[model samples]
Target chain A: MLRIEHFTKTYRSKVAVDDLTLHIAPGEICGFIGHNGAGKTTTLKACCGILQFDKGAITVNGHSILTDPIACKRDLAYIPDNPDLYEFLTGIQYLNFVADIYEVSKTDRNQRIAHYGNLLGMTEDLTLKISECSHGMKQKIALIAALIHKPRLILMDEPFVGLDPIASHQLKNVMAQHCAEGGAILFSTHVLEVAEKLCHKIAIIKGGKLVASGTMEDVRGQASLEQVFLDLEDTL
Target chain B: MIRTLVSLRFRALFTGLIVQRQKKNKSSKGTVILFAFLFLYVFAVVAGMMGFTFYSLAQPYHMLGLDWLYFSMAGLMGLGFAVLGSVFTTQNQLYDAKDNPLLLSMPIPPRIILLSRMIPLLAMNLLFGGLVIVPATVVYAIFVEFSIVGLLLQLLCLAGIAVLAQAISCLLGWLLHLLLSKLNKSLASVLYLVVFLGIYFYVYSQAGEILTAIVMESQQIASILSKWVWPLYAMGMGCLENGGLLLAFLGICAVCFAAVYAILSATFLRSATMSSVSRKRQKLNLKTSKTAPPVNAIVGKELRKFLGSPVYLTNLGVGLLMAAALTVAGVIFREDLLSAFSMIPGFTDLIPLLICAVLSFLISTMYISAPSVSLEGKNIWILKSLPVSGKDILNAKLLFHCRMTVPLCGICGFVLALAYG
Candidate 1:
């Protein structure tokens, strides 16, 4: 479970996120939708213990992200939109490095890396340097690294941008499987169709404010996700 | 078009300085002022040394009836230093500049881009050349019986030499970039280390003999400069006595600069357009083992980064490498070194302390942490999102520094103690 209360983040004179409150229960896939500079990335980053909010409390599995960041981060993983990884390291080496960071057991790391590497058809390229990888391949490696520890909560920012249709479908399955196994996911995406189909709940943000949030049915209600999103942007 | 690119490069170089100036806080503003004063002090000291060198040489060369030789030697030495300093900066500006892609994508021609990039490097050489040559010129004007035309030619030669130095350095920089590109990344650092060691050995081996000959038989130095080093002779003749030689030297400078610019624009544009990273795929072998703790892993990554970058290692790690090399030399030649020190007046008692002090100074100067954070740039978020304390991340950098430096220092300290005993 993840909870954010009255989250506010300011950059000098500009307020990036303001008075935002959000929560996600176990076994739920919460899709966060917002336009560019709408503070979706900021809020996601704040929850993942990467960004600090000016006035708010964010807790991951009852551990406050601000006060107990390591503990909060232990149960959550974040993959940024453009995953600029260590270009010097080979794909396998980078994955193993991240595994070590999260303290994954040897047996678990081996199994998880093999499974994901094969699933993404990246096993053959595991020895290739990250700098040599295509955009999609790099995205797959980052996704695998994020999932290596099997955190209870996953926060991804535009996780679908570089992914191909096949990889995107595989990722959708993985998200569903992760949620079904009692994990929660809060992902920001511009793809409303993917969110409409895969998300158990949805949150719409406008200018750093949460304009609408509820179960997918309630948020859209007789309107398509795109129609509902456009309506929210127009009014809010 | 060239002006825009030069301004962009200038802005990039002074971004931090500009930011400090924009700050509202008094302390930040004070730092900018402090840096300015520090820069001026360094410039003044360098110029002062140049002036002193010319003043010392003026009387000897005047007596030898070779005032031109003195000017030539001073200009050559000044240009030599400028070339040495400009090589690294030229390499950074032309080959490794992060803005290359953005600049290349624009509608400007490649030669204009090359010229624009070289301008800043040339400006730096000019600063260094002026510092050295201006002082020498003033001294020559005061002491030497130079004609008005001679004095004017001398000043022109000084500026001309700076441009020539920049041209040579840029050529060398372009060559290094090309050579390093063809070699494996791991080998580049090792190759640089070997080259550095080789240069050090050559300088140290030759310095005593060269200095002894120059001090005991100064005329021999002038003969060598005038006969073998034709450009130096031409420059001095042009500057102090002859106007025709000055025009010839200026003509050479212009030709060299144009030739280099043309060559870089033609040959390097293709190489520059391509990505810097090697495209060879690494062989895959997945072997599972128990991973290191987070801090250890971080330290390992940091070490890889430090070792992987030839520029970072060659420039910043030089001190650490020197300490190790010196420590080895101390152990190997302890008896000879001790006897040599004992020969000096009141030196035997302070040998151990002197060794320790030198080692400490070398270790203190290797601050890898200073630029390590900025090097991360876009990838810093990966660290921030990891399941580790901020303290651990900082400690990882600190520990990496300690790991590289402490063991060698400890060994040297032990060896010096044993030698003293």
Candidate 2:
């Protein structure tokens, strides 16, 4: 569902992500693993049309993110590591705003919001101003908003950071269900065990270069995801 | 450590105002020059008004042998102006500063942090207080009497008045923060703004009459001050070369300031950390959600954001408020205004042109669209990841601005037409 090729982004003189290429087909959950400042965010941002890359191309659902951003953006949703939403908006107001932007029908939005908000245990808090919410609550609100429109692809950065254990488990189920329903997800995470279990494919990046990738079995054969990541870091 | 923190505060203030920290949006030399010119224009306008008002009062007070009253009046005006100008800033800097938690997490004492924060606020008081005192002093010297000792005494009183003003502002700001904690955020902010604007406009509209009364009732004012508020009487006398009274006045100011500083510092810890989440929470049920076209949805979001932020609304939205007020005033005082305009030679025929010019100037005061993009701040990714195009977003913002202003302007124009024509 998402294709990234030769993606290179530089901030002034420093190269953030250099010539990175990766892809996730429909019904696949790709776990993107990397160290801090390893260009995972830059690649993800480029794929979702947030940051314009210095080099290379990324396409979402057969539309180029750079050339036809509107169409590409229509099929995807991105959630950043920090859920810095509009503190002025109530949770439901923010969700309805997202629903409107995606042109979700009133009935469709109502059902999806109820389902996701219930699963994340956020229905009661949805009327509270986002400024009053805890970090985990804000994360749940972000998750519910992202799913309100049912995009073809989802890009998440450190999606499980501020989630409670139960919400995290529910999110795992949600991700699996999304992929099962023919949607794709490219998510970056530090939790190797979660990535090992949840991702159908694995892509390991070190210093903006993909070191190991493919199915979980192909990337971490005879070794755990954590050990392979550490070995790659030490060797590089 | 205090000096370092104070300097960092100033740097932050400067960077936020004049310089764009992002490398991609580095402030150009032209932009800096433009901002400097704008700053100078505002200062010039304020100073010119003070100079004119004080100059008129100087001759009358000198002729009446009420020079102490003149000096005392300046002292009082300086204190009032400084307190009003810096009170809100003091509240924002002391309690609602973004870095309060960050600073508290470090090894610094809360009082020390409070002291450092107040230093910049004190400097602001000095600038505000100086604007009045300096002009009063200049008018006193040129049009009244200029004594060497008197000049030094006025300068000393200037410093003393700034301290008094800063103390009052700190107290008022602390009270305001406490009061605002109990009320809704936007409501409290709007009320604060309305009170401030009401005071400003009332003072401006009645300035001529108030000046006449001050000059006419100098004897009664002098008697009341000496009998009841003798420190102010001492302040006026000291500025006229009375050394003993000057020392007493300065001492009173010092003691009062010390007492206030003690009280503020004692409560700084608790007050600064006061939680603003005192509002009752409401349960969410989206059974009646509605959808709009993509562009209209963006515009709706823009409207919510505009109304949600008091800072944005009060600052740029003043033009809209003024436009509506102008229409009501125009209709209410139509006869008086027309008669006054007719009295001016050849000006009556140009009323429509004049009204249009005034309305245009007011409209130009609002630049909501420009700041709307930058104000997205950290949440900019939400817009970028949305299906909406950049052009669509800009148009939505522009549409929102039009929705706010166009109807009001049209109504203002239609009513004013009946009033003038």
Q: Write the per-residue lDDT of candidate 2 for residues B1-421, one digit (tens) a residue.
A: 9999999899888877776754437588899889989988987788778889998889888898999998888889999999989988899999999899999899998888988988888888888888898889988888877778788889999888888888899899999899878877667777778788988899889999999999898899989988998888999999988999999999988888788888988998889899888545676667767788888888888888888888888888888878988999998988898899889999999999989998888889877777999888888999999989999999999998898889999899888877786
User: Best candidate per DockQ, number?
Assistant: 2
DockQ of each: 0.67, 0.77
lDDT of 2 by residue, A151-181 (tens): 8999999999999999999999999999999
Clashing pairs in 2: none
Candidate 1's DockQ is 0.67
Q: In candidate 1, how many clashes are counted?
A: 0
Top-scoring candidate (TM-score): 2
lDDT of 1 by residue, A12-109 (tens): 99999989999999999999999999999999999987777799899999999988998988899898898899987888888989999999988889
What candidate 1 gets wrong by more than 4 Å, as runs, is: B20-27, B145-151, B184-228, B288-290, B344-347, B366-377
Per-candidate TM-score against the hidden true structure: 0.91, 0.94
B-chain TM-score, every candidate?
Answer: 0.86, 0.92
CAPRI quality of model 2: medium
